[model samples]
Target: MNKLIEQQIETLVEPLVSEKGLELVNVEYVKEGAHWYLRLYIDKEGGVDMDDCTDVSHAVSEMLDTKNPIPQAYMLEVSSPGLERPLKKEEDFKRFQGSLVMVHTLSQFQGFKKFSGTLVGLINDEIVLEYENKRVAIPRDLVKKTHLLLDF
Candidate 1:
């Protein structure tokens, strides 16, 4: 059921995102506590603003009403991924080179579960991280989560 809803949302959002000159980072339909929330993460070269989010939300809401993919009432949210955007794709990694990043590993490395350091580079499907005055090469697949950290 969740997969069906995700598919429908993707179908409905792709066109709107492209028309708005934004990239669809991710779409999630999940039940949190007693409420179901549909979140849409959008991005662009310069980043997204409130107007962009509102526009996408309005367009997506109208389309979802017509499609009727979700059975229950859900609050739809459209917003920027913020300073700590999830590095969900290879393109994101490439796009955010030389930025501070926080990464969690599926398996512990260096006796630590998380690494917060400079994103040195990506080479051959591996992420090179500079941490603790040393360089660590972690397999991209082993990363559970990777997000850009704001310096401020």
Candidate 2:
């Protein structure tokens, strides 16, 4: 159900953001405390600002209101992906190649659930990372989240 809602949202917002010359980094439908939230993480060449957020929020809000794709009540949010921007697509892996990253898998692998290391880019269908003087190839399907890690 949550996946469907997020898919519906991404389908609606991806092209809209693209048309605005921005990237829709991610979309999430999550429950926090007593509220449900639809979060849209966006980015541009120099990163997004408050005005970008507001504009996207207003545009998405209007679209959501018109389409009524979601069946439940939720708060809409638009914002940047922050320093630890997620690496979602193949291009992201290529663009951020050699950068530091942290990857979390859906289940434990190699006696660990998370790894912090230098991204070796997507090789074949795996996210290769060099950590602790060794390299590991994590199956992309097993990766629950992959984000750039900030050293500072």
Which candidate gets the maximum lDDT versus the true structure? Answer: 2
RMSD to the true structure for each prediction, in A, is 2.4, 1.0
Candidate 2 residue-wise lDDT at 145: 98
List where candidate 2 sits over 4 angstroms from the true fold. none
TM-score of each prediction: 0.82, 0.96
The weakest ten consecutive residues by lDDT in model 1 span: 87-96
- Give the per-residue lDDT of model 2 (tens digit) for 52-78: 999999999999999999888999999
Q: How accurate is candidate 2 locally (lDDT)?
A: 0.94
Q: List the residue pairs that clash in candidate 2.
A: none
lDDT by residue (tens digit), candidate 1, 20-132: 89999888899999999999999998899999999988888898889888889999999998878888678878888888998899999778888888888788888888878
lDDT of each: 0.87, 0.94
Clashing pairs in 1: none
